[model samples]
Target: MAEKFTDEEFAFLRYARFGSLPERVKLEELVALNETEPAPDYSDLAYDAKERAEG
Candidate 1:
């Protein structure tokens, strides 16, 4: 089965695939302006994947 994705996962995937740092910062700015919840922790996701592979 395909992996499930949280909102942060989708954002991180989009950022990694198509966004520069400036773009990400801009997205954050936009989210803040709109009073949206913060995106998920992509680094945590990455760490979890690495841990799964190593173990």
Candidate 2:
């Protein structure tokens, strides 16, 4: 846990967090999937109300 980990220390850190030799991309995907984005564009929701208003 020095200011900068040595090569061995860095390798150990990565393995500890991700298990042995895990794919970096898979880790990124997992983290991304767990993240919450905005409510997404729902301004176009359709319902019978719009039809009733039109007719």
Best by lDDT: 1
Indicate the TM-score of model 1: 0.35
TM-score of each: 0.35, 0.36
Deviation (Å) of 53 in candidate 2: 9.2
Position 8, candidate 1: lDDT: 94
Pairs in clash, predicted candidate 2: none
lDDT of 1 at 26: 55
In order, the Cα lDDT scores of the candidates are 0.81, 0.70
Tens-place lDDT per residue, model 1, 2-31, is 999999999999989987556234554554
lDDT for model 2: 0.70
